[model samples]
Target: MVMSLALISSCQWKKKSSKAMRRRRGGAPEIHLDLLIEILTRLPGRSLMRFKCVSKLWFSLIRSRCFSNHYLTVASPPRPPRRLYMSLVDHLECNSMAVCYNPRESALLLFTSSSSSSNNATSFDQDLTLPGMGGRNMKLLRGLILYIVCRRACIYNPTTRQSVTLPAVKSNIFAQEDYRKSVLYFFGHDPVLDQYKVVCIIVVSSKKIKRITSEHWVFVLEPGGSWKRIELDQPHIPTRLGLCINGVIYYLASTCMSDDIIVSFDVRSEEFKMIQGPPLVSAFKPIDFIEYGGKPSVFDHTRLRRKGLVELWVLEDAGEWSRKSLVLQPCQMHLVNKYTKWKVKGTTHNGEIIFAPLLLCSPYYILLYDVQKNDLRKVRIRGIPKHWFRKPDTNLFFYFEFMDDSESIMHLEI
Candidate 1:
């Protein structure tokens, strides 16, 4: 009887194994190219990039013009209401948390507590950790984060846990001393060419008033090949690196002690040309680059007798830089004065310009300036001691970088 039971179990196991093999042979259902693209479009950018390696059909589909147009159309729709976060250092230096908030939610609550004297500090959310982040200059480009650490750069998609490290750049071309000089890094995606480009500026510093040197590097993210660095005639050192609007990277350069010049880099042709800025006002603060109304815009600040005012400029014509609209309004100087010196920290998704007031201020407050409607709001985290922004305990220093979600995906797509 025992032998009979054992034989019966063995036969059952063999039958199960045979069924598994049959299923394996049957394989997954064949998905048509259009159907595959529809499903692929639903997946995040990083997943599509990985799917390229799955099969030659997938590679052709993803790299096709129709796929790119559809991807951009679906991925970059009308801006959703977003929440911004800034990291706060806890007792452990390495362990930090971030506070975030959705401005739309805040607006709903504002009407209920309309008479409240408190400056709507409750809009800010609780703490979140800065996980999987290494020291780097990060930029948000089209729903992905681009992080640059040392000589290496990567595109990280936090939502999908997908990251692609770019190939190491050739360090031998630039001298060690030249590398130490102030350099501007800009990352962007050009759908026209279906490629990603990382632009690096190597500026020559001089203590003398009239002396200047121009040195720079351009690295293209080619398909299959590693990042190829292209040498170019050096333009002036750009004060601020702009985003890619229509296949070009715009930069604001200080032409003279008093003049500011807008320069642009063509990703396809690898050329540099100058654009126009706003009309000059006495004591004009340099314009900060931002994305507004689906195009590249600039935020210019001017203080009239300690009262701060700001203006937004949008590019009306790609060929004619002079064609721009200036929208102006008074700025909240109280919020601006919280930091030691106010600089355009960065721009946010909701057409708000974030200003980092103090260079050394810790537990920093992100000042949000709405260029379209002329409004100012401050985002500060709770439970943070005021002393964090005070002078450091020692002479130690720390650097802060803001990473965007869009640019991160573009790297992996490259």
Candidate 2:
């Protein structure tokens, strides 16, 4: 409906702007651009996207940073995004060695709540297979999702259903299998600069050759944006994707010396720094990255098996932390296997930590662990795509990535 109105307004505006341009021709536009922008900014995002094509003038107005910033702040903050998106991938039961779950098929699944305040099961909406060659490294910011396709990255505005691929960095490593094994990606937005950026880390393997090296690169989200390579002296294998908060991206990276070491990259400065990790850094142990009270944090999956206790380690300073332990209730304990391998999917904006079992030993359900109450509740998600649990080839298990993200109307320059 908003898009329809935006289209209607653009048609009307085009008629007016045409005469204004003809009247001024070589002079000032009869319709002041500032006045025109003010009126357009009030329209829905869907309308604005269509209006961009009305004329070069309208295109520049909608894509300008000044206009986007104004549009973002003009309205009351969007009701905290209840829309949830998840990317699920599980290996098939095919003969011989297994193949990658089709990156394009059943790659992304979305669900929307039936009401603003209801706690009942969520209703499934739609599924989207991101464009481009379809590579992993999926991250979302504001309302734009950053994903890699064909070894190159791209920004997608799901609100507008528009996408722009990032320019590929010139390199020979993309052809090497070793490079694929140690690649990590982080997508962040700098509120200070109102800019969206991508941080790519590639760790060179030593056992494959010798003397390993790690490289970093930054890609600004804009037209003609290219990867600008950065330098890093130490080598670390990234275990999970980076989490963005307050313009910084943090993730657990393992050095040969320690598994708790965290590597932080300032999205604006493009600099790398190290911070002390919480005590439980061990090899082969899965670390669930989360956000607690708006600070980056992590918890051990190992704690769950020990009487259903999970310790949340939140980073307060570069090398400091505030720890809190959440104990699962007996009723919650009965919901799933007491010793099942469970992983933290994410922390909700309302200060809740979400978890799901690695193996579907129990029925499909998500545990919402409340931080303040230390209680767990189940959010049963319905309408999951059929492909999600259908393991035609392998019935052993199905693994998926669960993400709790926000919805925004932020427009992309591309």
Candidate 3:
């Protein structure tokens, strides 16, 4: 509806601007370029994409990087009626959970819910389907989603329904039959360059665990893009999914000397730096990365269900961390069940932490905990596919992600 109004307004403005130009001596445009851009920015992506055919000028303007940045800046603010984006990959059989689930066999469902004025109920509607099994390892940034499909790194734009599969990185570790090898891929966008990049790390180790070697590769997402080898001085094993804040990609890794370390890579500079991680870092810890108050934070809810204790670790500087502990209030303690495992999915614009169950079930609901008010409430999600819950004995696993903003209309290059 907003797009329709914007289109109507544009048509009316053009007629008035043309007459004013004729009356002027120099035939100058009555509408300033900035004003035109402001009107176009208000329209959603689908309408703007269709409007590109109206004229060459409109096509070029909408495709420019400067315009994309301007549109993002205008649309990124936290307004009311925020949305929650979720992706679920369901494995129906118990045997599928024991092994690597094939993307062809499983179902990947997308959903979105808008927050009501009362913040009481949220109803999700099914979204576009993609060719991948999204899980906890998947990462969503800006208007794109990054996931692995058949061992290939894939970046998908939900707005455009466009996907780009990155070229495979060549490594000798894959051919080494006697040695164990693992690969990790991270997705990030460079704000300065206005480009998307994928970072690949391959770690190879033997049974002795004495020697470890790794390789790093980087790929820029654009036309005629290819993977290039990069260098890192110290070899470490990445333990978790990468989190990109601003233009830096951060993830947990362990070196030969210490088990807790944070490796940060600058997307624009392509430089790697290591920071001393918090003392609570561990391979088995139940923690998630989130943007809290415009800074990178580690949400540690390992004991939230078991003991009702939650820890927030904020990165203050290079190697400094500020920690705060919050325990669940006695009255709201009933909301948590010790038997049901929960994970910190993400945060709302108002700084509320959303908690989701690890196991999938019918009548899906999520918990919202406001740090400021020290309150907890459950918001039930309606409109999940009925077929998913038809068979009670069927095993299912779900992967969910949330963004506390509206849909992005940014066009992707690849």
Candidate 4:
């Protein structure tokens, strides 16, 4: 009986050894390319980026534009996952005077969090850090974040940790005249043409005539990208950052006659349309122009903490306006401090408007208000460096955006 058991064990060992030898000798079972691609599309972007080194074929596949688009479609669902992107800058205090001491030493951290619902508490994971960039006024569109670094436009891909800097706009007016000039960049994606473009506006104001002259330039985000000049009949001063929705870039602007208007730019057609701005939206300097329920909506929360009610204006159609008032619950009113200033960062995919503090504090937290249910809650932000809170003389300046999870492995050029 013992000799029989020994023989059986030897046979089993030899069978397993033979299978291993076959795998080592390139006799492993083959998987179809399509099947492999399908399996890879379901993985997270970080994993797929690391898998690029598995083989030459994988490197090409993972980096291809086709694969990137497919992966985006697979990863993006109807509701999509929610992520928060933050750009923070620290200023040092010298003898009670606050100043940006060192741009190189300042930290620009991007944090990402995944949550199924907007009400649940979400924890952030520190994803990427760019030292000295000092990103300002960041705009996110289709998995790419556009920001300004020293007045130069930069597009960053968080998934692949890659960034591309666009050429600065050359202003002939600034070189020749003594006019005060400012440059602003707006990023948008054309769904019809499937292209990303940056709109650069240079506004030159002459005190002599009290006139403002503006020039518009467009640059597509592709290989060999160059700025092309576009003409506009009226020169308007942009008052806030551009909000792009459905291939249209919208922003509040003031005409040369001091009339406030909403300027809409078509990303694909490269055309500009002027719409008369609503009174409340134009009068408020810190008003938030956000996308609410798939339309361009103006969110006025200035009297939220004081009166416990907020006003929302939606652009129903061409030049048509609709307004609604949302009153917060009496129970949740404690979360808001009547003295502290709060700004509407953006909206979640579920249509909940997110409000964040304008001033930075040690334990940072954001509030979410559900217009439909009249519910409000706060979510605490974590993962900030302890030293930031420890230093009493440092002032933190930051901008945050809550967006759908749209990670991509796409490569950037030009």
Candidate with best lDDT: 4
Q: Give the Å error, residue 375, model 4.
A: 1.6
Q: What's the TM-score of every candidate structure?
A: 0.63, 0.78, 0.82, 0.83
TM-score of 1: 0.63
lDDT accuracy of residue 178 in candidate 1: 38
Put down candidate 3 lDDT per residue, 300-411, tens digits, no spaces. Answer: 8888887788888888855589988898998888899887778877777688888988766778888998876778999887766667666343445555566535455556
Q: What are the lDDT scores of the predictions, listed in order?
A: 0.50, 0.62, 0.70, 0.74
> Model 3: runs farther than 4 Å from truth?
1-32, 76-81, 90-105, 113-118, 127-136, 178-180, 206-211, 389-397, 404-406
Scored by lDDT, model 1 comes in at 0.50
The root-mean-square deviation over C-alpha atoms between each candidate and the true structure, in angstroms, is 11.4, 5.7, 4.8, 7.9
Q: lDDT-based ranking, best first?
A: 4, 3, 2, 1
Which of the two candidates, 2 or 3, achieves a greater TM-score against the reference?
A: 3
Cα error of candidate 3 at position 266, Å? 1.1
What residue pairs clash in candidate 4, if any at all?
Answer: none
Regions of candidate 2 where Cα sits further than 4 Å from its true position: 1-14, 17-43, 50-59, 74-81, 90-106, 109-117, 127-137, 149-151, 173-180, 206-211, 359-363, 392-414
